[model samples]
Target: MSKSSFQGTTRRGFLAGTAALIGAPAFATQPLPVQEVEVSQGYDPLRPPPVPEPPVRHNISSFQAKHWQPYFSNLHNGAILVDTQSRALHFWSEDYESHMLFPSSVPLSDEMTRRGRTSVVRKVKGPSWSPTPSMKKRNPEWPDYIPPGPDNPLGTHALYLGWKYYRIHGTHDTRKIGRRSSNGCIGLYNEHIAKLFERAKVGTQVLLI
Candidate 1:
């Protein structure tokens, strides 16, 4: 996409605001539209769950670097490599000579993105989210469940990895994509995850480094 494609007033403002909010608290005080729940924790049950700021759609494509890498051809077709140090993911494409690589930002977190080799085990569309046991222990106020939708933390699609509680999934908060923000799962832009969902299959190897 060209730089001019993102020059509209609303788009520019959103982009600027997103850049400013990096490193800010992920949660906002605004109340979510969902029903309320009571809790023992200090959190106000009435407060809305933190939703990510509206995504600057072209920000990833505009700011993250992507390029062809013939070296990726050495990997099996459809193999994925997550380079946490670079905050990028690489997939070896079937075509070796022409377009042999696909790259996208895959943000890492100190707590998440464990270094290991795993494979895609399953895939889901509009995946639902339930806070893991550790997450609930940290914040007892979290909802028992969040159905699939805009408010859901896992966006449009999910590719379950072999590891428990870890997956390659889309994020409700696009701002978190290129940052160290997840618990253990790899996150991608909603659109990028959707495209990846269509291409990746069960048993596809995934390497994190």
Candidate 2:
């Protein structure tokens, strides 16, 4: 005879009794309810999380050394190359011993841009500013003139070019550097301009490209 029959108890009945004896719940014999999880559309639980890309920096200008021989015949007084596309200025000393690269602000638009050769005709420390007739026509509300001071548009110093109404100058608004923010001028930082002013002569050769 089987053990269950000999004991006068069935196998299933014995197991249920044992479960109760062990303090197992009455519903322990029944199947568990299925759980529902809310997931977003197109989301795959098996997929690995995506990595984010690095942010692009727009404000920084690209600076590099350049050869003066390709651009100029000779570094007579000195040579200054203003690269509008790169928004940078390059300077080479007369003896070609010293070289400097400075971030600069170029013309705001193509219409305002004047390319080709020019020379530093005059340099003024604590320079005054006067908006051109074209600038005045464009912005009638702008001031006619600005005296040399902190409020001056041409900050600290100015290098007047051979071209009429064009200058390589310093700006009080430093944000203008490494950008296309000038009406028709190439702009530099006050400190950089001051250094350039010291090294550069009135006859410094300038080329805007």
What's each prediction's TM-score? 0.62, 0.71
- Model 1 TM-score is 0.62
Q: What is the per-residue lDDT of model 2 for residues 1-209, given as tens digits with 9 covering 90 to 100? A: 11111121123453464355445542133422322222112211211222221222223214444567888999999999998987778787887666666667788789889999999999999998878998888778778887888778788999999999999997776556655677899988777788888888999999999
Candidate that would win on TM-score = 2
Tens digits of per-residue lDDT for model 1 on 35-111? 21111112213123224334333233223222324223344536677767655565544433211122233433455
Q: Report how far residue 162 has shifted in candidate 1, in Å.
A: 0.2
**Clashing pairs in model 2, backbone N/Cα/C closer than 3 A:** none
Q: Model 1: how far is 187 from its true place, Å?
A: 0.7
Query: Model 2 reaches what TM-score against the true structure?
Result: 0.71
Instruction: Give the number of the best model, judged by lDDT.
Output: 2
Q: Which whole-number lDDT from 0 to 100 does residue 57 have in model 1? A: 35
Error of 1 at 168 (Å): 0.6
